[model samples]
Target: MPSGLYRCIYYSKNRIDGGRTRIASEIESILAAARRNNPPLLVTGALVFNRGLFAQVLEGPCPSVEKVFEKILRDPRHGDVQVLGFEAARERMFSNWSMAFLGQSREDQNLFGHIGPQTGFSTERIEGDRLLDIVRNLAFEEEARAA
Candidate 1:
């Protein structure tokens, strides 16, 4: 029997509450953690941080995705966690990324108009499907740019 596949997209505040001038350190720490933790559980995903918000897609075995998401919720660095999308996916959109981080570069900011300077994970400003599309497109776009 094949395992069930699941995809979850969520948005959260992008502050490391009380941390000082170490956002880069904090983000690297999170990525390192994901790299170490995700593979064992067969989880694959990408994370985006733009306009002071975090939007991420977690896709893999249903249970594994849930487990990692729950960990994300418990982490104190993130706030205002909201699930944008959660459903069964036909396949992984970010199979190559354990946790790819998309920064607030000019290019990244231009990927979606909704992620402007003032935007911060508002459901009213971005729908679930659009959020998924943005992340998926970001993954591919970034890859193409890299290549």
Candidate 2:
């Protein structure tokens, strides 16, 4: 019954701007806000942050996803907001979480290894199929952890 599925990946500057503590708190605040807001909009997503870089995929109603992403673009805590992917999806890849976060967890490291190092927010090196595979893997891993 959903209208559309919107997904996006982006990276931003964190270390040069706020360092570890600041970024940690920022992530917490992001999760808090998402928990409070995403359900209302039926938004769900997965995020991975490492070494001052962030790669996130948001899925849900097109309007809600775009609105949330616009807010992210305007947020001052992060800079160099470069979007890696933006397109319509057939279904939600992360339906369980309003915002599922993957920090430097073992699973995260594994994923990074598989996807290879992504410099900046550039998606030039990551194939679309591979990106979706990574997202799917992270989604399942996160869900298992929650269980």
Candidate 3:
């Protein structure tokens, strides 16, 4: 049921109270390399400034995903960016998106159809409850901090 060759959960946290400028700098650095890779990447989920971490799901071809992570791991801005946890996804949560760039927002601005109700992620074999649980938990933490 899975693409097998590719799937990864990008779990990372910045130094506590790194602030938006710090986070943005990190993102910009990653994007610089991501743009070069020219790979199909969908940022299905994100936990920005959540519990002092910047976590997300980056799904695509295995090579591209690995390359992205390698770049991130090597980036100076990714100070203390730790890979917390993850699993092999059955399919892609954000399949439709060729590339997904995200920031902290709650308005459900889904670039890929997979993120919103239109794609029906459950039908695609993704565990909807689990996915949402992670997002919600992180959102609660991030929103509280932002507030």
Candidate 4:
């Protein structure tokens, strides 16, 4: 692990209410807030939403990552927040992004299906490392597509 860097991986039940428009707006609001708040704190992460669930990876200085996660725990848009992993990290996987949003594409759905097969996409049984790998892969794929 690096000097003061840490990583947090977690999943939460999505609590945003409304139709597609409302949900889309709420997600935008989340990305907007993360972009605004994380730069100063040197936090970078990726968020994936699928089947009414959210899986995310946060990386940064220990205190900054914890601060950001505390805010996440209090956010009403998320519930049943479960920390899959929180430990010192050697490096950030999403270093270039303040907060990357990985949209739910067919490929993503298939990936999630494989990860959470027993309970219809529930992240409860998934390991932190596995979830982290999935998020990292999706983020990288998104980056590549953009490039």
TM-score of each: 0.84, 0.78, 0.51, 0.91
Please give, for residues 23-141, the per-residue lDDT of candidate 4 as tens digits.
77898899999999999999999988876788889999999999999999999998999898999999888988999889655423655776567644483777888888888888878
Question: Which regions in candidate 2 have their CA more than 4 angstroms from the true location?
Answer: 1-3, 15-19, 107-114, 117-124
1-147 per-residue lDDT for model 1 (tens digits): 345999998888876854434776788899999999999988899888755678888988999999999999999888988887888988888888788876545523444455643454354457678788777777777788889
| lDDT values, one for every candidate | 0.78, 0.71, 0.49, 0.86
* Candidate 1 residue-wise lDDT at 101: 75
Model 4 regions lying over 4 Å from their true place: 104-111, 118-123
Write the residue-wise lDDT of candidate 2 on 30-117 in tens digits: 8898899888988898777765556678888789989898997887767777676788877877777888887546523544553466
Model 1 lDDT, residue 93, Cα: 81
> Per-residue CA lDDT of candidate 3, range 5-105, in tens?
45455444455346667666766655555555544443333333333444455655566677666766775543654443344566665443333444345
Error of 2 at 38 (Å): 1.4
Candidate 3, backbone clash total: 0
Residue 74 in candidate 1, Cα distance off native in Å: 0.8
Model 1 CA lDDT for position 139: 76
Best-fitting candidate, measured by lDDT? Answer: 4
Which of 2 and 3 is the better model by lDDT? Answer: 2
Local distance difference test, candidate 2: 0.71
